[model samples]
Target: MNRYLLAGAAAAALALGAGAANAQAKFDVKVGGDAYFEAGYVDQDVDSGLRSTEFRNRMRINIIPSAKADNGLEYGARMRLRANSGASNTRTTDADRAYIFAQGTFGQVRMGVSNSFNDETYVTASMDYLKLGAYDDVTAWINLPSSTAGTVTGNSILNPSIAPDANSTKIVYFSPRMAGLQLGASYTPRNDSSNTDISRSKPTGTLAGTSNGIYQDMVEVGANYNNTFGGVTVKASAGYMWGRAVDDVVGSNYKDLNAWQLGANVGYAGFTLGGSYIDYGKSGQNERTGVFTETTRNWTVGAQYTTGPIVVGANYKNGKDAGSLGTTGDRELQVYEIGVGYTVAPGLTLQAQYDYFDLDNDASAADDKGNVVLVRSILAF
Candidate 1:
């Protein structure tokens, strides 16, 4: 069946379910979202001598509905829609996320487009109070030179990590917590699903020469534990992802790409500390030889302190061969950041941050340092 049609069918089914819930008066609905704005000044020591001040803003709304069955089973659905300003005075609206889930003592089952086990479970120390803005430090850094073949660009700042495909249809299962431990798993038939249009067709034919379509039959599993010891609370998680090669011209050349991550956090008094490490193994293949030739790894450490309505935090992140794809030369990045967030009122927060990026072996023959200062305001309801 056409995937688009299937998406429509799923939507219809969900609507019908919601209607039935309304008729039975067993439904609960809530609407909430956030409005965010940021202004920042950037300074790059590169040859171009780029120095600029920018302003950006975005808004989103989330609709959530849930119901509980007489047999102690609960079902829920979430849909998020967003509008943001773009370059050249362009604005766009999109359904960022839509998913349905059911849960009970047996555990929980989630279907539709959502985060994978790896993404949902991994722990990190970055202060993401305002994820809509410069949440991570990598954006300030520059990429270095490399020698390996088949270089791919536009890698995520959080490299060596596994994330769900963009709007790819998938199923995820999360086991109920037991003794502070919980497990999760997910499966995706194809990774080329569209986020903006659910009716997009899946890619087919040979993947050898295709610029897109890389993984098939992807599977991910993760586990996390949360517990407190004495005056300190701890949270830790680990995850792994593996997928089968798609449309490989040579079996060996097109090998399965795998990634894993380990993270932990501890909180004591008003202070919290944590770190995470990620490794993406041979995920890139040489475009010429079609052979897997590159790997990426990175780590992050951070600390935060909170008192009253104010929180202050600092973090350091380092990446080796970050986003190098299959290149051979040294590609490295380091980010140091400090920030403070204050609660001005109910559902409103203001934050100020400073970030420094240190780049080495950068592909661009320019200065290796850059800095940014930003102020952000967020209102949620």
Candidate 2:
């Protein structure tokens, strides 16, 4: 059945009575965002040239203009400005998320530079201590070397989902939720292009042995479930992605992208247990002879408890990939973490976490292990 066939009144009713929270909200531009300041201390075996302590902070602002038609058709445009560049680069701000969206009885649609469906809605381990929602920030403290760990492995050990889309220019469709389940999909012409950038030429590999990470014509399909039964809450997500690798040159044979993600969570009385698994099966690897290749994957599981304004949590994450393709084998990263948070006031909180990490290299005996502690203050409005 055609979604447009559905009556606009029905859509308005589904969203709540016409007096809904954002009814015809287009008259005014809305602004909101978050900021965080973090201080970290690391003691690792590989901290030869790295400092034992560092401070980092990030800020973002979201500008959204939205309106609802008399027929209940809602339309909006959003731009998220970010000032996250570290001391390594210029302090210029950039808009990482810029998109336009429309919603009605037919569900919702988003176009422009935006994330894939999976990236926007993948479930994972309970980690309230982490910033916003990131799994690999710990890698920054370790300062792992590239020479020992090879190419296929990513920056973080926990691959929570397929993120190759990287917020490229794309179109996404979301189905109306039914019985606590929602479905979504996205299409990207090229994963490497974002914002105002445009490239009609085919991406081609230039190096002889290195694999091309760029992919074209990417597609993603995903689903999520969120419901409460009695005193227990359940949440889950699954997704798959595929794309064509860059055009190959002589001595280069790049594998197409094939990635998937699965995750779930169970919560009751402020206590939540969750985990996730992600796999990129030789995706974007140079399969030609003399170039090493291996499955890139990661998994994580953990639990957290929240009481009043305080929360505590712990989790384990393991990630592996064919690091440094020319290297003999894969590299592994294991992290055991514990953290706590205290809410000081509305939109403000303090958090601290401790992490024990172990790094194992398949190429040689340059194994490393260490501990990291981070303290952070967050403000959201």
Best by TM-score: 2
List, residue by residue over 1-381, the lDDT tens digit for candidate 2.
Answer: 122322232344345523344553555589999999999999998766778898989999999988787767677889999996747777878888999877776687788887778888889987887778867788877876554222222325465868776568887777888999999878777877888898888867655645767777777889999999999999999999888887867777788888889999999999999999998888877788777888888999999999999999999999888777787788888999999999999999999999999988875656899999999999999
Clashes of each: 7, 5
C-alpha lDDT of residue 278 in model 2:
92
Best by lDDT: 2
Clashing pairs in 2: 26-66, 150-323, 150-324, 151-323, 151-324
TM-score of each: 0.82, 0.90
lDDT against the true structure, each candidate: 0.66, 0.80
lDDT of 2: 0.80
Task: Tell how far residue 38 is off in model 2, in angstroms.
Answer: 0.3
lDDT of 1: 0.66
lDDT of 1 by residue, 297-380 (tens): 678888999888888999888875423333235456777888899998988899888878877743456327778788889998
Q: Tell how far residue 168 is off in model 1, in angstroms.
A: 2.4
What candidate 1 gets wrong by more than 4 Å, as runs, is 1-25, 47-51, 86-89, 126-155, 159-161, 164-166, 195-213, 250-252, 287-292, 322-327, 362-367
